[model samples]
Target chain A: MSLAFTRRALLKTAAAGAAAAALSRRTAAQASGRVVVVGGGFGGATCARELKRKGLAVTLVEANAVYTACPFSNAVLAGLRPIETQQFNLDAVEKEGIAIIRQRAVRADPQARRVVLEDGSSQDYDRLVLSPGIDIRFDALPGYDEAAAGTMPHAWKAGEQTILLRRQLEAMDDGGTFVMVAPANPFRCPPGPYERASLIAHYFKTHKPRSKLLILDAKDSFSKQRLFQAAWQELYPGMIEWVSLSSGGKVIEVDAKTRTLVTDFGRHTGDVVNVIPPQRAGQIAQAGGAADRTGWCPIDPVTFESRLQPNVHVIGDASIAGGMPKSAFSANAQGKVCAAAVASLLRGEAPAEPKLINTCYSLVAPDYGISVAGVYNPRNGVLTDVEGAGGTSPVSAPPSFRAQEAVYAEAWFQTIAREVYG
Target chain B: MARLASVLTMGGMMSVAVVVMVKTMPAAAQGVAPPGATSCSGCHGPGVSDAAVPPLHGRPSEEIVAAMQEYRNGRRPATVMDRVAKGFTDEETRAIASWLSQQP
Candidate 1:
């Protein structure tokens, strides 16, 4: 047969096969097959919504009934926005014929294609999407745990703890110390702890001029460090202090009860302690053996299928998609791509692996903002960085650029929220 | 020979479809390439010089790939490029970059 005939025949056969698989659902609801998505954050939410739109039966299991986003949680910590701004009900997702389960996923039986819930309930699926977000490693840091969080609020999850940390800031006396401990790299939102520190400084400048903010960082340098340092010097000098990992800035232990954080250099007492501990894949992903020693799941970039198991896809922060940072935008993009691949798989077609996009925005101050964005692609089982794809905040940008950045920050938040929750 | 011409035409059309799909789909679906490497020329044109977009002629492959990646994300801030770069795999990025870099 001619090559033309061969190509046409292949396309026809593939299309027919896909159609048959899609239409061969066991039940009326399962005609497109069952897709159980663990976690209702950016990645899971986007996948669930898109898969549902594609005529798939989606079941989204989340630990919290209402998702309090970590995206805008910084505003809550800085007292600029309320916690309600970040709180979202899963009503929209549920309305899309998705079975929203409000319970923690305990373990996943990859071999059996089933997930076990904290309530001892077991659910089955033909394909599963896991985007369970991040889990804090309390044990990684001595004297830091659930008990420590009571006094030293991580505020990383961004809900009640954000408010608690904010309240602690409010009650501090003028000239009181606000200590922030930032974790090393490969943590959720590389720019988060720095952004939090910047926002707090803004608050101090306006509300408590005499107050001081000290950052105890685990890393030697930070994302957008030049911009952050420059802004801090220009806007809030003497009001903020940053100690690097080499400069005795590392936190060795914390006495949460006394609000004292001990470092190699010395011990310091804080009126408010904001500790963002080291993070890993959410407990469910780790427990399922989807995660590796690095505390994240390894997946085939083409299909987002877990490296450890067949027929299971891990997306978002849980998946070690190299070169793609763990951000809401990255997770959202991965979620959609993975959903398409999953849908294609059920239809007995190969998933089309696509490029991924990520952009992270930080509020350097109320009117000033900075960001980094990149496009990533998978090569040889690793996501290689697409060089020259994105750049850091422009050096010495004009006020108008900064002002526009502030507006874009708001718009970007709304855009991602719509993409995930709308 | 008629069959060969028909096959080539179909390949061209599929390349266009892939470009349209990559450019128009949301940022997540950008990097996926159609079955063969020939589809690249459909949008890029037979080398950068012939394409509607800027010719990739003689540019460093790494630089070209970097530029595409930037365009796909909001960082570089190019409207058409962002659409074009979506859903690309790393291997595909390198392949396209190498192809454009090698074009006369």
Candidate 2:
């Protein structure tokens, strides 16, 4: 109901581009209005920071003071890197003159254009950006409630569960079997499950050479499947086995207490069971009525404005961006596009034609990396992958090529992190 | 004025200035960031990044255009640039490069 304006709300932020100057001139008083952003991940942070950079009143709402990034949290699972390396703060964002709200957004009222926080206060916005990332559908998956997640950690959201899964693997016997249930498609990070399995297998090959990784996948195919399978054979030979959907890889139920997973055809019990359950848009996105029947937000490809809700732009894993995998890279690109679009719309103009690019790098081993790249063009509000551009890494590339990809993977993470967090 | 312009363009950059037809360019692409320039920061790294990929900021527009053209025509080898280069036309590439050439 009330506008959540902090002391810095009226601060003269630096770096207002010429475009913003023209936009403010065109729209007059309304151009520099409030743009409240929810969820402070790659997508939200970039969008909020960009909006502020354009001289708009911006507020970033995040539940956590420190963000634990999911991009390279896999390395932390292997003990190759510490969790601290994956953690980042919003100090850089705050310095840019955007107000940061350290409270969970419990609800969003689209009619009022108000975002109500858990503490009962709300922020009204001229344009609202929702980037709440993904929320696991604990109810959709049988026997996999929020409580069950404590026993059989999914490690999908990173941070606490990542450490849990890794700690469990460390405590298991050397010959112990580790079963990981991969979720279905349209989920965040298509190559994540395979990458986690590979990294965990890498840890095993060194500390527990006799250990095995059994991946129960919901789909028959995945992003860069051939590259991942090839790397698995070359590096962790006979240490990993994959069961696809038709082979009864879909888990019907999970018993966290027994560390067991039940599929339609068989039951699998492991020393450590990791169930990556089905996922949908975060609760706040659904609460805001941004999501549709698909349980994901359908957005205009150019503007990222929710098709279901007016004036609310959804990005990151929450929105169903066509041809773009739900990746941090895609989110960052979309966020930038959306910021420009929002700024233009505030001045009552159609957004410019947007060109979005996404490159997702996955580490098959610490030294072996693979990627899937795509460039998308939005035509008639639908995004199509540009012809003759962007595809998977060379499946048959030499070890040297794989090693170079691994180095680039680390660099990509660092580059994207700086672009968003700073 | 000569010193400032020289420092800003870095020599090769000014050559493209006349070729760039800013009047004919799309209004949205006129400023610091071009049509797809912001997308580059997602991977190429932002300012002063030691992040493996070469920073495109402050590079000469002509050099950037040449590299992109080479990548597009398969004359250059790259992990991802080859694929990305094909997405942009020579005009759009020049527009993006010109913006990067002026970055501080």
Candidate 3:
């Protein structure tokens, strides 16, 4: 059967159960009304599935037919996991009666509650869910553009770029340097760059002992600094080096052809260069008028409804969720909350005060792991970390403890992937 | 406490120690999963090949409560649950367990 939808059954259900919901504070709720979700990554896919489960007609628009997840992608680069394992085809969700539109969302017509696709077709929604993860600010730095990405290889989005960087590493001479330039604050996965460095360092230790890895960081410190530094000392000592911003580690420009990064005071060259650029909300979010000057969509803490657009909600990395980092775990959590709120709004009921949780586990090596977690509760109109109840992996833990965490890290992936994708 | 807060302000995901105390919880509600309870499914999700974490659906509420209380009080050793358990009140935990129990 065609995958766009199985409307024969859906129309029968909609006709049988005409909803009798009260008029919403803003607009009347249609229990069987359409919800169009943009982006099929963690947040949008989860939201689409949840809305369908709530007995709503849901459509998910995505640029790619298949999704490549970013979580655990660093392992793919280090040869710890195969790239095939990172891919997800939404067969499970498709069978659940969700219409998966394989097309790019070019614009969002919030005023008409419609989404315009690259092919000029449009889907009208009673409610719109925008979960466009992030867009790399391509020319934010000089000498770096779409063409430069072919050479430098951001690999930040996973998939083909991830393999490009890995192949480059494999082809490099044993003694050649692999350098990564990490972006400043407000990026996806705060602990990600350090974890990449650690796992890559592990790969070097086993295959090319003479090779070295260098990190040119925009910030002087990062999440789980002590744990990562300690793991580097114990697992791959003297094989990795970090350059903090105070020491001119921040790259002002780059020469992609020459593989050189121009910092404030000096120039550094590497056999392999990975540039993680600054980011903003995806194109649709900006086009839909959901995003603000900060390059992120501001939303109500309770319902995640866009502050700028009525009947439109933004979640995941694109939304400014307080005290929540841009991680898949956070996106999944936000997806649930946003889905529930949309259901309630359609039913003309006030949204509930929900508690959100985030746990980010980073593998410093195949066997060594570190994490940071928090529970975000609503406080004074914002989500705040619950007092006395959130923290990172404890310092000075034994090797066995780290090993156990590594096991849990894999479980975390298996469980979340099944929940969201299926 | 002041020093710890200063450290947390950097990453903003740190926690303070909590004294675990058991208290009377509300009777479980039916129909829908609680707000905080949905987050649990992100990790303790559907029973698929049975990995390191156990799926929570359909377990007895009493059994789930006892386990959560133990983790909250540090009596049960866990990689991360000890910290997560302290985030919820006894009432919230009981409601979630009740919801999970009602699930098929």
Candidate 4:
């Protein structure tokens, strides 16, 4: 594509006139209220920025100075892209007039409408948004804890763990086996494990042809199973193996010392073991009483307001967002809707009915991609997919379509990054 | 300084030109977006110049309304739009078209 049609070009045009106009109008009508957001990932950052743009007093609290995105971390693992490319700074968001507090939020006091930071400071808000992503339930899997993570990296959080796993792959012998234990459903990035398997297989194809990848999945099936299976068969036949739960694929425990995985059927040893454990709402959500037995926060689908805590909202992976997956794009979409709703509520007006959209793209290979899209609205207090609204890429599509989707996937990442961070 | 002055002058003229142009078209409700229209902006709004996803701003209202009606009725072959169009009522579609048409 031409540079003139890139995401940056479009952003310049949109921001120069349309967005400024919208902001001025919003400022004229909306009442200013303090909105505090915890976590500076896709959802929290977007919420903070959007609220600020709409003339709200906004503050964002984050533990990290930079965010390494999870969306394309699989590419980093496959050696297709460097991990540095996935890291983003907060310059753009800070420039937008949202206060950035580089501190860990330890607790939320809903009654007081404030978030307590690790430094003993508290930021109060008329409205609070929690987008703390997910916390790995290390106890869910025996023998898999922080210590074990050093040897068998989950690499799901997309930072140091990603580098560790990549190094493990590099050190493995040509004929060695790499075992991956996929997490159960409701985890972040439903199609991620399969995509990682495909990319790793691609890596082995080019670098270590004799190497084999074994995917021990906890779920019976996964997102884009057929598409992934088709790509595996066509691209890296016999190099990758996938075992489902019914076939004794669920990993019950691990012996990190021996680098062995224990499943219901048998124990298998590998040169490298990557275990993605079960997940729950980030600790702050649970501590704040926003999450329930399911380990996810329940919310009003219309405004993403926490059902348990008044005036507090949850978005991103930590929330039970009906049918939406815990992807970066979904978080960004929910952030915008929540911002609009909060802006209206601050003005003492009823929140506008919201419509949510999501599109997740997974690359099977460098030039081959697949996607799923959906449009959703609140129905019976839960977000439900609009009938016949969105679907996945056609299985019978030509190679060119997949190639185009790969390009579109990159464009989407660029556009969403600019939208949320810049 | 001269270039900055020329750019500011052009920007002022552009804003004036837009006002005059919008005044010529039949005036619609100013601020409110249609109930379901904001969702479309996620993909089709400003800063998205993808050929596959057309920008919705500055389009003729009648043309947009006609296209949405066709999508809703299954006359348009769409990957996703047909289903999304069905979510909006005809009046809602017209409202969206009217609002988007007025955008710069």
Candidate 5:
């Protein structure tokens, strides 16, 4: 089927379902509407659960059968966590009576209120929630493409690619160089790259003490720089090396077959290279005209509705929520809030504009963790940061606090996992 | 009579101290803004540039609240913003929203 016809049919079906549900609830004191959510990650999953709990019929779509988290996938690289530790089934959410469709969304019909599926089937909804995490813009990086990724893994997606990178690390001999190419900003998990480097170093410290690690970063300063540096100095000094943008750390090209990473400064060859390229909103956003020049969807903060499309909402990593960082937790929170607004609108009531929360924790080592938190609100339809609303992990903290941070990090993972899948 | 006066002075001093100790303090120390509102302009104001960090003034309050709430709730994964929002109350967030809406 053509993409256009598919979208129209989906929208028509949703409108008809909504009309029938509305009539059925006319005397029931509550209205029913179908809210279809794309991407079953942290953002989409939580939003689906919230909508379902609020008495809305929700259909959740995901490209994969199981959910794997990138937050602690670093531990997978370090051998601290087995791959299965980060894997979760959607059984809990399925038990909640949410209609689950294990298919990737190909396109969104904003006018028709339907999502086109990879299998050529489509679903219609009164409200659509999109939270597909991110799209790796490999073309943005010279010499890096799908074919190149096969040779040099960009394990940014946190599933099979993660294991592939880990296996590559395991195969390297002592004194071998492990190269990590950090992506530009506006990507998921700001602290992820640093945490990943720290964990990989941990692996080499015990197994291959003479081996070295090099990080070529696109940005000058990174999240939790001080804390990460302090931890690295204390734990594994002279083992991990970082080159920043000012020092010519930005990777301009790569020869994956040769395992060489070329920065403006010089070329460095490594036995294994993990290159994370620039990112943008997921494919569905680009297909729907929701993406901007920067490749992220612009939305009205109050409604999460696409600025270009009237009834379609974008959430998670796919939306341009300026001043807001994309994280699994952030996406999940936005999903719930978006669900609330969508449900209220469907009920013919004005949606309550809401405050949002974001918190990110990065484990510097097995025993150490640091985090930052913030509360955000909308101003003039643009998302703005709240002042004095959030801060970072304390520096030079006592042992008790460090230990406590580690405990909190684990608890946080569990909480977010449940919020998304359950 | 002098002795009696001294006793009364000491007793009153003790009473004041006890009362002060029992009184509840606000969530954050003094000179702080309430949650979700004008309280954020303190550090996020102009003249404080953290590289690419954008200024929070003159933006929409609805977006501000959602962003703040996103930080506080861990929906947005930021390092510093999340910690700052842990101190907010829902009512204070509304108050902050009101104050931000009136700003430029």
Candidate 6:
């Protein structure tokens, strides 16, 4: 079918289907129950939106009135995109019949089936879904604490810190050294550090051509390492240097005043330091008693129900989802799956088996991108990667192909944002 | 005696087959969406139309199934679909195609 014709037909069909669903939902609304969602990022927001769409009453408790996405925050840091582009209001979510509470969730009482807010008020729920993303572990690195973060911005959460990092880069003189300390594995966004390095390099290449970037990585290998390295060599040769853990790249301590990084083997001084510390489940997860010794909540891969708490499920970065890295796309997918499970549980039905998929794209430059895609299935109580299903972008792809991937990457961000927030 | 024994065995097998069919028909009718299909909505579902990625909804089941098989088999050129199509088994692909075919 012609593309235009197909789009028109699909729109008509969607409108008809929506009308039918709305009519049925109105009749079924009498039996629907309340679903309380904590955190308002990709996973929580998507879950809340999906539940509300299904005629269920949903309450979304988020500390921030506006959510700034982390997916493309690197672009903001590099001055390629404005921070405002990453920020979203809750108006779209509110229009979907979700009760938006702009207050911090202090605790989750599973036994009481209620969540306490910072204001001392508690909201009762028939079911609770937690999508609180992650918390920085200050103790992971000695001398690297919350206070240190102001001087050495991580900018991982995307907001004021992002602006700080951008301003620091802009202020640095030509030929100055920029240093980045990457986090360990099982953290949010495995390829994030490398992408940040690439974008920062891009900035320096354009404005401060004589500047240098040093990356101190915790892990020896990273997601799409070969692709990133190749792009760096081709795009900004001699401008970026990556030090692996085996080569004393792991930063064990930091001095914010001196702008120094201490590793097991040696110490390095730089003009600008970006320290991304280790991470754990968001504090509310720990407060709720959902997190375990590992500092992440264990979940049933099929239903995302917390092994620690009944009727309270955790998704996104806080949940130990097997074989699924913590990415916005993964969280978005998990959100939909969890929403379906929560809906089924509310109706006193068995949750269906879930198949999950994730595709993460990283931009090395404004016009160069690469991606990895995977499909997963719940097997033996854990999500396992389906063999022969997903793969990374071809290593030998031409520049034109890479540029096209970048376009798709931006489109994906736009589409996902609409899906989750709207 | 031989003829009588053969007839009894055939009758028993036929009755079991009928019972199995009766048990499975309802599940087939109430078709649950297979895993991984919902994720497609992020890019290929509603509110996304870039011409690079085609819409999967409202397509014929046979057409959808054929396209996926081609992508999986490397018979079709793709930017990312080939990698994505490999993630599903033929049966899973069929299930996804059937689900999408029924969608508006």
Model 3: lDDT to the true structure: 0.82
C-alpha lDDT of all candidate models, in order: 0.74, 0.83, 0.82, 0.80, 0.74, 0.83
Rank candidates by DockQ, best first.
Answer: 2, 3, 6, 4, 5, 1
Mind giving the per-residue lDDT tens digits that candidate 5 earns over A221-319? 988889889889988899999999999999999998898889877999888899988889888888877888989899998779889877788998888
Question: How many angstroms is residue A394 displaced in model 2 relative to the true structure, after the best TM-score fit?
Answer: 0.8
Question: What is each candidate's DockQ, to 2 decimals?
Answer: 0.04, 0.34, 0.34, 0.15, 0.11, 0.24
> Per-residue lDDT of A135-240 in model 1, one digit per residue for the tens?
8898988999998898899988877788889899989888888999999888888888888888998888888889998999998998879888888898888878
Candidate 2 docking classification: acceptable
Q: lDDT tens digits, residues B1-104, model 3?
A: 34323322421211110001111222342376686888888887744423456666655688778878987998766668778888989999999888876654
Which residue ranges in model 6 land beyond 4 Å of their true spot? A1-32, B1-32
lDDT digits (tens) for residues A32-51 of candidate 3: 46788898899999998988
Give candidate 1's error at residue B83 in angstroms: 13
TM-score of chain A of 4: 0.92
> Compared with the true structure, what per-residue lDDT tens digits does model 2 show for residues A189-233?
999999999999999999999999999989999888899898888
Between the candidate structures 5 and 6, which one is better when assessed by TM-score? Answer: 6
Candidate 3 CAPRI-style tier: acceptable
Interface RMSD of predicted model 4: 8.4
Q: Give the range of the ten consecutive residues with the poorest summed lDDT in model 4 chain A.
A: A12-21
What's model 1's interface RMSD, roughly to a tenth of an angstrom? 13.0
Between prediction 2 and prediction 5, the one with superior DockQ is 2
RMSD of each: 13.4, 7.5, 8.0, 9.4, 12.4, 12.9
lDDT of 6 by residue, A165-265 (tens): 99999999999999999988889998899999999999999999999999998989999999999999999999999999999899988999998999999
lDDT of 4 at B102: 78
Ranking by TM-score: 2, 3, 6, 4, 1, 5
Q: Which of 1 and 6 is the better model by TM-score? A: 6
